[model samples]
Target chain A: EAGVTQSPRYAVLQEGQAVSFWCDPISGHDTLYWYQQPRDQGPQLLVYFRDEAVIDNSQLPSDRFSAVRPKGTNSTLKIQSAKQGDTATYLCASSFLGTKDTQYFGPGTRLLVL
Target chain B: QQQVRQSPQSLTVWEGETAILNCSYENSAFDYFPWYQQFPGEGPALLISILSVSDKKEDGRFTIFFNKREKKLSLHIADSQPGDSATYFCAAMTNSAGNKLTFGIGTRVLVRP
Candidate 1:
């Protein structure tokens, strides 16, 4: 089976610019998650969804970040007016169930905000 | 606060030697632990996992030794090979807490032939 897939494998933007990362989860998975991984660090959860409903998004920067899974099969994470601090790899993962199940991750979209 | 912590941010060992990565968690409720391995420029992949009820779990050359009372665990890679080099992250999660994982900074392992 195909693993989680993400678009724009790499993105470079100037400070204050906007970018959106897209994800297509596993075909039969019900849980999807977005994580940010800075250099030399572990992946940090930003938001997650079960089907088309968001389960947790406390880590997301409310003012500049937003995510949606309107159709329950795909997801989009958008960062508006990005800053240099937002430079990191954005990973998309999917699980058969929720976080209790094994999570398979996509290669990730590497973002560099200058 | 950091819920999970790992030791030896980086390590190197001969191909035939064994490499041990240590991790500890602060949340007593964390009942599931999983180790993920990531190569440069790639996403992490699940290496192995264990539940709280068990103190040990082994898969091929990888073994997890857990200590519930100590809230710690160690991942042991035996007969290491050069291709085994990667960053290993230790993560903990509790069924009660939405099963969201809390991960350690990660340990970078380099197996030299």
Candidate 2:
């Protein structure tokens, strides 16, 4: 089976610009997650959804970051106004709801904000 | 506050030697622990995991030894190979936390051939 896939493997933007990252999860997976991984740091959970319903988004920066999984199979993470601090890799992961402990990740979109 | 902590930001080992990575967490409620391996440009992939019920878990050359009482754990990579050179992250999650993972800073391992 194909693994999770992400679009626009890389992105470069100036401060205050907007960018969006898209993700297509593995087939038959019902749980999707978005994580932010800064250089030299571990992946931190930003948001997650289960079958079109958001399970948790407390870690997400509501002022500038937003994510949605409308149909539950695909997800999009958007940053309305990028800042230098937002320069990091955005990763999307998925897992079966029954086996949520084992998550598979995508290549991730590397964003650079100047 | 960083709930999860990893010791020795980096390590170097010979191909035939073993590489050990340590991890500790402050949350006593965390019941699931997973270790992830990541390459330079790729996202992390699950390597191994252990539940609070088990004190040890082994897969192939990788082993996880957990100490629930001390909230500490270690990942042992036996007979390390050059291909095993990558950043390893230790993560934890509670059974009631909706699968939210708390990850450590990660240890970058370099296996010399």
lDDT of 1 at A114: 89
Chain B TM-score in candidate 1, rounded to 2 decimals? 0.98
Candidate 1 docking band: medium
Report the CAPRI category for model 2.
Answer: medium
Error (Å) of candidate 2 at residue B90 is: 0.4
* Runs with alpha carbons beyond 4 Å of true place in candidate 2: none
Cα deviation at B93, candidate 2, in Å, is 0.7
lDDT of each: 0.94, 0.95
| TM agreement with the true structure for every prediction | 0.98, 0.98
Across all candidates, what is each one's fraction of true contacts kept? 0.82, 0.82
lDDT of 1 by residue, A1-114 (tens): 888899999999999999999999999999999999998899999999999999999999989999999999999999989999999999999998755799999999999998
Pairs with backbone N, CA or C atoms under 3 Å apart (clashes), candidate 1: none
Best by DockQ: 1
lDDT of 2 at A28: 93
What is candidate 1's DockQ?
0.79
